[model samples]
Target: MRRREFVALTLPSVLVMFGFMLVPLYRTVEWSFERVSYGQAGTFVGLQNYLAALTEPRFGRAVVFTVGLTLVVTVVTICLGYLIATLVNGLGRMRPLVLGILLVSYVIPHVVGAVSFSWLFDSNFGGVANFLLGRLTGGDVLWFTDLWPNRLIIALNVIWSMLPFVMLMILAGLQGVSRETLEAAQIDGAGTLGRHWHVIIPSIRGVLGFAVLISTMDVLRTFDNLIPLAPQAVGLGNESIMLYIYNVAFREGAEDLGLGSAISVLTILIILVLLYPSIRSILKEAKEA
Candidate 1:
């Protein structure tokens, strides 16, 4: 294709992005400079929002919570996904059925999952967790009250919503693991666990890196289920940064635009920093391996 034709084909996307995303984003930066609603709107104050966001306890806690949730959920999803993929891959005829179940879970609406999770963790009698409590812990426990429980529920929800995709990717990676390679390894005296620990894992590192990148980015930005799941928790001033931004933009009261913009910019930076290394390593390994 000619350069001009290539440009023509790409022009519409470029134009749409500039018109919709860039224009509004630029205005958001402009808005962040002025004191708006958190106090009175006033003349430009360079870096005030950034400074305020840095100093604010709620924003600090939210940043910590957001990163922590991303870390916890990403680890859980990866581990669980790898385990599930391992189990399904060896199941022969059962593999397709298992994969189908995973697909259904993946396709379920988030709100529906949220409702299910709510029922499962209902502190009162007969919820699954509560029902099991008597058998294990001597009594039922409130799953959402304390800090660890709240975080656990949120992480579990994230892991549940996220695991199917992770598992699917892992399964794909497993499929790519050639049978000849496995047979060769087995002939060399590699046991099942040894093959997994060395051969399978090394072979799929790139896939895992890509999966981690996608999961971390998505999990960091997730808000809907998280917010509803932990509504009563003191603003850690958002359950996550996304939730914080939502509250700043659309909450019934206290819509502070500047703070939200500052936070949004910070959020973008946080994601970039988190993803840059994983992406770089993935590309590097793809080149090497």
Candidate 2:
């Protein structure tokens, strides 16, 4: 295709991306360096907002909670997703049905799913899960008011929501694994675990890496689920980075927009750092190809 045709075809999309993404990003960065609120002129504040975010004890707790949740959920989801994908891949006729069932959580909106999930544990809502656990362990678990228990439910909710996408990605990767390679590994006396660890995993390293990258980004920005699942997040130290930002910038009686924007910039940097290895590997693979 000619350059003119290429530019014509892509110009609209480029403009749309710039308008929707770059404009907001620029505004956020600008706001981060100024003392601003909604619909008011911002005064220059230099790095004061950033310094405040860094020094705030609540912000520190929010970072620790968010990062810890991201690590736990990402690792657990990848492992469980791979396992479920492997099992589903071996099915012949039931694959579609199994996948459909597994994808129900993924297809549901996060807030709706979280509300439904919370009902399963909230005794005020006649929570079946809490009842069963109480019968089994002889104690009522405080899923909302407590720190660790709330964290567990939040992590579980995140894993539940994210598992299907990861599994589907892995399942797609599994379809591209060579039958000949697997047979050769088996012929070489590799056991099931050995075959997975050596032949299958290495072949799908790129897919797994991509899954991890996406999952990490999603988990880092987790907010919707916490609305219902961790209502007491601020008090219990269960606040995610996004939630903290929301409380600071948008929540009633707290319109510290500059601090929120600073935290947003810092969160972006943290995500980039976390995803650097996976992104570098992808670039290397693309270059080699």
Candidate 1 lDDT by residue in tens digits, 1-289 = 9999999999999999999999998877877787676445556888998999899887778788988888988998899899999998879887778788887757887767866787778755347876777679796555666677778788888888899999989989988877788889999999989989878998999899889989989988888676557776563233788887877666878787887888888877777887788678789999998
lDDT tens string, model 2, 1-289? 9999999999999999999999999999999999998999999999999999999999999999988999999999999999999999999999889989999999999999999999999999999999999999999889999888898999999999999999999999999999999999999999999999999999999899899989989999999999999988889999999999999999999999999999999988987898789778889999999
| Cα lDDT listed for each candidate | 0.81, 0.95
Model 2 lDDT, residue 1, Cα:
90
Task: For model 2, name the residue pairs that clash.
Answer: none
Candidate 2: regions farther than 4 A off: 275-289
On TM-score, the candidate that comes out on top is 2
Worst 10 residues of 1 by lDDT: 230-239
Assess the local accuracy of residue 162 in candidate 1 as a C-alpha lDDT between 0 and 100.
91
Q: Which regions of candidate 1 deviate over 4 angstroms?
A: 37-42, 123-126, 235-238, 277-289
Cα RMSD of all models vs. native, in order, equals 3.4, 1.7
lDDT, model 2, position 55: 99
